[model samples]
Target: MADLELLDKSIRRVPDFPKPGILFYDITSVFVNPEAFKYCIDKMVEIYKDSEIEAIAGVDSRGFLFAAPLAEKLGIPMVLIRKKGKLPGDTYSCKYALEYGTAEVEVHKADVEKGKKYLVVDDLIATGGTLVAARNLIEQGGGKVTDFFGVIGLPELNYEKVLAPSKITTLINYSGK
Candidate 1:
């Protein structure tokens, strides 16, 4: 694994972003640093290399950054879990709650094949709503969510409880912003 201390420093903390009194841990800084970006994916691969994952289900946008390369490295299929109406064909949708309101996510009905195992990837985990919803969409489409992986985790929110019974792995954790 890469030096987590140095990787943690690469992440930028921005306060009051998109709202008042909310400290946002911006991952864009990590994306710019090749070493940090590779470290994040390397650690994730190291952790799951032997898990026999058949596909990687990446939550929209930021999740694609890490998941795409990781899926390439692992030689597995990459499944996209997108927002409502973003997918073209038949899709399975799940509604999840955000801090302020609820949002919906969708996955193509054909992408999640039966008997395949998937790992859900995201940039970060706060309330765990998105990951939970992603897992639901995957299962509802006939694939199993083997695990949930994130580059960063905010344990202060106690997302572990919300994602109970399924394992969640993260490269770094911050108690608060």
Candidate 2:
């Protein structure tokens, strides 16, 4: 079994980050701690190791860190789900709401294969807007998102309801104040 207790303890919480009245759950600390990082990958690998995941779709920047190693371990290709304009050539893009504004994400047009199953990975799942947009972008390119995995989740943000019907997994969790 995964030692979620340790994972929880390893996480660093900072108050009033990016703006006041916001508590940021930083995953960078996990990257710094060898055991914490290993546990995250090990748990993720254990969860999807037996599945038919054609490719792993990592949701920009941080997601790439976890997805790359897991995809390699699972012997599957990893696809970049990047910010709009970050990827060149033809691409699939979608906009999603943020706490303060809106942001866009995209994937290379040729990366997604029709009817292929994919797993989306990210560092955190807060309001689920970003992941929802990522899923829509994948579907637009004819790829199906079988599941979504994140290192931390805040269900207080109603992420489950927002990402309904799709399997959502998180290694650590936090409740809102």
Candidate 3:
């Protein structure tokens, strides 16, 4: 078992965020702590380092932070997954439901080479909507998503129903209890 004592300690929980009856796991604290940040990136790198990953694909917003450092450490290029219409020039998009409303995300069609292996990174996995959308964009661009990595995961959400069956590795887990 991967204990997340330090990882949990570094995370700050915000209740009823963006909607009622929801508690969001805020990662700014972990982002600020040098040891914690390095631990997270290092752990992720350790697991996927031998996965023959050619690119580090990060989900929009918070995912960009970890993806950048992970890419640098792994000596690979990083692809940024963004909200719909955020990317310019021949992009791929996927729309999905949010806690309150519908939203869409996009990626540059040329970001990844065909048949390249990629690891998708994100800050959290609540409903797995964002990760799945990102994976869709990557596949649409012809890259194979070998794994989905996150800093936190909520087991209460239907992860299996959303994301394609793939190796999911996380540094911390808060089951939405």
State each model's CA lDDT, in order.
0.91, 0.90, 0.84
List model 1 lDDT by residue over 51-75, tens digit each. Answer: 8799999999899999999999899
Query: Poorest 10 consecutive residues of model 1 by lDDT?
Result: 1-10
Model 3: per-residue Cα lDDT over 33-110, one tens digit each: 777887888888788777788998988889999999889988999999998877877899889887778899988888
In order, what is each prediction's RMSD in angstroms? 1.5, 1.6, 2.1
Where in model 2 is the C-alpha error above 4 Å?
Answer: none
lDDT accuracy of residue 49 in candidate 3: 76
Note the residue pairs that clash in candidate 3.
none
Residue 55 C-alpha lDDT in model 2: 92
Q: What is the lDDT of residue 88 in candidate 2?
A: 77
RMSD of 3: 2.1
In candidate 3, where is summed lDDT lowest over 10 consecutive residues? 1-10
Q: How far out, in Å, is residue 18 in model 3?
A: 2.5
lDDT of 3: 0.84
